[model samples]
Target: MSAESSGGQTPVEYIQHHLTNLSVGEGFWSLNIDTLFFSIGLAVLFGWIAKKVGDSLDPDNPKGMQNVLEVIVEFVDSQVKDSFQGRNPLIGPLALTIFVWIILMNAMDLIPVDLLPWLASLIGIHYLKVVPTTDLSATFGMSFSIFALIMFYNFKVKGPAGFAKMFLFHPFSANNVVVKIILMPFNILMTTIEEIAKPVSMGLRLFGNMFAGELIFILIAILPFWIQWIPGGIWAIFHVVVITLQAFIFMLLTIVYLSIAHQSQDDH
Candidate 1:
C-alpha cells in the first residue's frame, strides 16, 4: 500500500516509531542500539579531547577547545575535591563521564524528533528512539551503574563490617541490646528503601523530563505546517536550556549521592 493509504500514518504510529529503540532482542532483553552507540561514542570523543587538553597544558597560553576543556576539568576537579574527602582515582573520571554522556544523550532531543525515525521508516525499520535519555532503560542503566559505584565506595571507606553495622543499627539504634535487636529489622527495611530510592529517583527524574519533552515535540509536529513552526521553534529553544540543565543536575545529584553514601557512620 502507498504510505498514506496505510491508515495515513496515524498519531499512534508516529509516536510508536519515535518511542521505539532500535534493539537486538525481544521484550526486556532488548537493547537500545542508538543509546549504546551514541553514549559510548560521545564518551570516547569527549574523554580524548579532555585528555589531550590536559596533557598539552601550556602555562604560557591557553586557547580554543583547550581553554574550554580546562575550565570544565578544573570545575569538576574542584567539586570532587570539595565534596569527596578521601582519595578516589575514579570519582573525577566518573563525574566527567556522567556529565558528557548525559549531555550527549540529552542533545539528541535537538535532532528534530521526526528526522531519524522518518529515515528509519523509509528503510522498513519502523521503530527508533533517537534520544537515549527518553528511554527509561538507558537512564536507569546509567543510574544503577552509579549506584554500584556508590556502594563500592561505601564499603571501601567503611569496611564491610562497618557498612553492615550502619544498616543494622543506624540512626535508630538503642543502648539496650534487646531494644536494638527489636529495631534491627526495621532499620534494615528503612535502609533498603533509602538505598533503592536513590537509583529509582535518579533514573526516573531524567527519564520523565526527557520523555515529556519528547512527547511535547511529537505533539507539536502533529500541528499544521504553518502553526507548527511557531510553538515548535519556541519549545526547541527552551528545551536546549532544559536538556543542558537536566544533564548538569543529574551529574550534581550523582556526586551528592556518592558523597552522602561515603560519609562515616559518626557523621550520619
Candidate 2:
C-alpha cells in the first residue's frame, strides 16, 4: 500500500496507514485534511476550466478547446434536458458542475496510490489520502448538500401548507377523520424513513464503491512487482468505467430528486 520503507510494518499496518488521513484534531472535532485538500483543489480546477470555457466561448468560430468545452456543455445539457422537468435556470449549471466535479474527484483514483503519500512524507506530512470519494465524510457532505436543496425546492414549489400536507397524508390517507388520524403516524414514519434514506443511500453507495476500488488498488500494489501489472492494469481499466458511472449516477439521482421536489402533489 505504501512505497516507503516498510520498517518491519505488517501488510495490515501498511493498509491502515494508506487509509489514514492527515489531521490535526481529536475525536468529534477531527477533520480529514487530505479529503478536504484534494476535494477543494479539484473544485478549483473545475472552476478554472469552466471560467476558461466561458471566457473563450464563440458560437460562430468554435475550435480546439472551445469545441471540447462545447461538447462537454452539450453533453451535460442533454442530461439535464432528459432528467429535469419544469423551468429552472439553475438546474442545468448545477448538473454540469456536479457531473464534472464528481468525475474529477473519481478520476483521482487513477493516480499511483503510493505516489502522493510518499511525496508528502518527503515534505514532512505523515499521512495523505488523495481520493476524496473514498472518505465517508466527503461523500456524505455532498449528499447532504443535495438533500438540503431537495428540501428547499420542496418548500419553494409546494408552499408551507402543501408541504405539511404531503407528510401528513402521503402513502396512507382516509376520508374519515378518525381513520385519517389512525394512519397519520404510519404515514409520517414511512415518509420520514423515505426522506432520510435518500442522502444515506446516495452517500453510502458512492463511498462503498470508491472504497472497494481503492482497496483493490492497494491490494494490487502489494503484489510482487512483476505480477502486479496483470491485475492492476485490468482493475484500472475496469475502474475507469466505475468512476464515471458513479459520477453519472450521482448526477442523475440529484436531477431526479430535485425534479420530484419541484413537483406539487397535484402535479403528481
Candidate 3:
C-alpha cells in the first residue's frame, strides 16, 4: 500500500523527496548544502560540548555530562592506543573525532523522516537531507582525506625510495632484469588498485549502510501513522547498534591502516 496523495506525491515520490539533497551549484561542482550544513553543525556542536566539559572537568567529582564525556574520551583513547603502533600525537585525537563525528551523522537516521522535511517545508525549502553519511560524496570526501593522510604517512615513514619500491617490487617481483622489466607494469597496476580500493571501500561501506537505514525510515514514513510505529520503533531500537558499530569500524580501520603505513618493510 502507498500513501494517499501527499501534496500529490506518491509513495515513491515521497521517498524520493526525502532522499533528495538541498543542493547548489551545477554538475561536477554541485554541493549538497543540507549535508554540509548538518555535518559541520554537528561537528561544531561536539567541539563546543567537549570544550565545556574539559574546562569544567573535576578529577575527584566528575558528574553528569562531564562523566559521560570522560567515558567517551577514555574509550577512544584506549582504542587508539591498542590498535595504533608507532603512533603520531594526532592519532588519538583523530580517532576520537572520526568516531564522534560519524556517530553524530549516523544518529540523524533516528530522527523521524518527515519531521525535518516537513519543518523545512514550512519555511519554503522543498528538500533537506539531514543525514550526511547517507551522501556518497560526503562519505567519499572524508575517506579521500584519510587516504591522502595515509599516503603522506607512507611517504614520510618509508621515504620516497622505499615508497616507490613498495609498488615496483611488491607481490610479484623477479630477480632477473628482463623478467623484472616485464613484471613491473603488472606489479604497479595491482599495487595501485589495492591502494585505491581502501578509500573506495571505506566510503562505500558507510554510505551503503546509512543509505539503507535512511530508506527504511522513509518507507516507514509513508505508511499509516498508527501502524508506522511498529516497524519504526523496532528499527529505531536496532539502529542504535548499527550506528555505533559503523563508527567503530571506520575508526578501527583508520587506526589499522595508519599502523600498516608506519611499519617498516621488515615488519611484514
Q: Which candidate achieves the best lDDT against the true structure?
A: 3
lDDT tens string, model 3, 1-268?
A: 2356358678878888888999999988999999999999999999999999889889998899998878888999999889998959989899999999999999999988877887898999999999999999999998999999989988899988879878887768778999988888888999899989999999999999999999998888788877889999999999999999999999999999998889875563
For the record, the alpha-carbon RMSD of candidate 1 to the native fold, in angstroms, is: 2.9
| Rank list by lDDT | 3, 2, 1
Candidate 1 local lDDT, residue 218: 82
lDDT (10s digit) by residue, model 1, range 13-63: 756656777789888788778778777777787778877877888878989
Candidate 3 stretches with Cα past 4 Å from truth are: none
Error of 3 at 64 (Å): 1.4
lDDT of each: 0.81, 0.88, 0.89
| Candidate 2 whole-model C-alpha lDDT, 0 to 1 | 0.88
Which whole-number lDDT from 0 to 100 does residue 213 have in model 3?
Answer: 94
Cα error, candidate 3, residue 197 (Å)? 0.3
Q: Taking the candidates one at a time, how many backbone clashes does each contain? A: 0, 0, 0
TM-score of each: 0.89, 0.95, 0.96
Q: What value of lDDT does candidate 3 attain over all alpha carbons?
A: 0.89
Return the number of clashes found in candidate 2: 0
